[model samples]
Target: MSDADAPLSATPRTRLRRMSQKGRGDRGALFEVLRAGLVCHLGALVDGCPMVVPTVYGFDTTHLFLHGSVASRSLTTDAEVCVTVTVVDGLVLARSVFEHGVNYRSAMVYGTPRRVVDAEEKLYGLRLLTEHVAPGQWDYTRAPNGRELAATALLALPLAEASVKTRSGPPDDGVGPDAALGLWAGELPLVATWQQPLTDPALPATVAVPAHVAARAGTRADRS
Candidate 1:
């Protein structure tokens, strides 16, 4: 079985302390959250300064892959990094403002990312990244050329040390004193859907939109 298919063990860094009730120890939860989200925020220390950068990411069974231009300062370093992906599901409105919260599914991964150097792996990583963002687009478009590959940098971070947390349902004050207040106390669902594809104006009239791209229109962006 692939690493992704295997279970995950919580590390010291990944263990949740504050909201232990929401923490998920299973590997499947981590993989599910990562697969549903499109973008990830990468936190790292660069030149003694802390930086968090938002970037596109992809994953296989064992590792998460991040890619950017070779000139990008964030991708060039060997420092340890924290990657997080979150999907907001709804807004929890309570009787009190302080009790309000957001319903979300999130995952945090910690590790020192290794820069990908193998030609074969690099290409494979790129393909995974592309398909993650837009399924079936990789096979439809031309593969990356040598010049493009040389300019790009890919980094792989192990998915071993990670934490997954999720919050759902209604406000927590349903049985509390705040429930006495005559205010709305429920969840306002938040959803994202893809709109119809807009074709390039410069494209030939005969060049039609591919089925895979066209089919995604009006579908949930976070669908697994």
Candidate 2:
């Protein structure tokens, strides 16, 4: 099978013990979850203690990129880390409170991240991060200078060890004993959309909003 069509490896850390049916093994399914998320929680060991920090990230077919200050504890090279991204689609309200659950798509990525030191790759990684957060902002804004690049840390973690799990549709109790209860049960869908652009107050009145920024208004923030 092609790499994109290959099933995810069931490694010790990535195997789903519970609700295994919800686990997605296809790489395409994994990419779908990542594409729909804008932020990821990065977990790492800092000074013998665990730390999980939410940060913006960008990913390609082989690697996920994250950037921060050079001295940031969480960006240490060769450190084993776990990165997770989740997108909540809705709330499944069941007949009983115990059966109520969330409809979500989540992925966990495990790897030892390496610091990006090559000037060219570092710049490209930064571009990926910027464009992931704001599509047209990279070309619209000034490029990072030597001093700026020196102070910033860029990390590239391989996507080889990753797992995706998704849950959707109604609650499982619908066909069970709870179905006899005279109670309403359904899904409360949740959607996130972009509002109209808020121009910076510091900008001159003569300046107009960029077409790329203005176009995002009223658009759905989550692709899935």
Clashing pairs in 1: 4-61
* Candidate 1 lowest-lDDT run of ten: 1-10
For residues 1-224, write the lDDT of model 2, one tens digit per residue.
77679887689999999999999998888788888899999999999999999999988888999999998989977679999999999999999999999999999999999899999999999999888878899999899999999999999999999999999999888889989997999999999989998889999999999888898888878776
Candidate 2's C-alpha lDDT? 0.91
- Tell me the TM-score of each prediction against the true structure: 0.96, 0.97
lDDT of model 2 at position 196 = 91
Q: What does candidate 1's lDDT look like per residue over 1-224, in tens digits? A: 65555656766888788989998777888988988899999998877888889999999878999999999888744678899999999999989998899999999998899999899999999998999989999999999989999999999998878889999999999999888877888999999999999999999999999999999999999984
Name the 10 consecutive residues with the lowest summed lDDT in model 2: 1-10
> Which candidate's TM-score is highest?
2
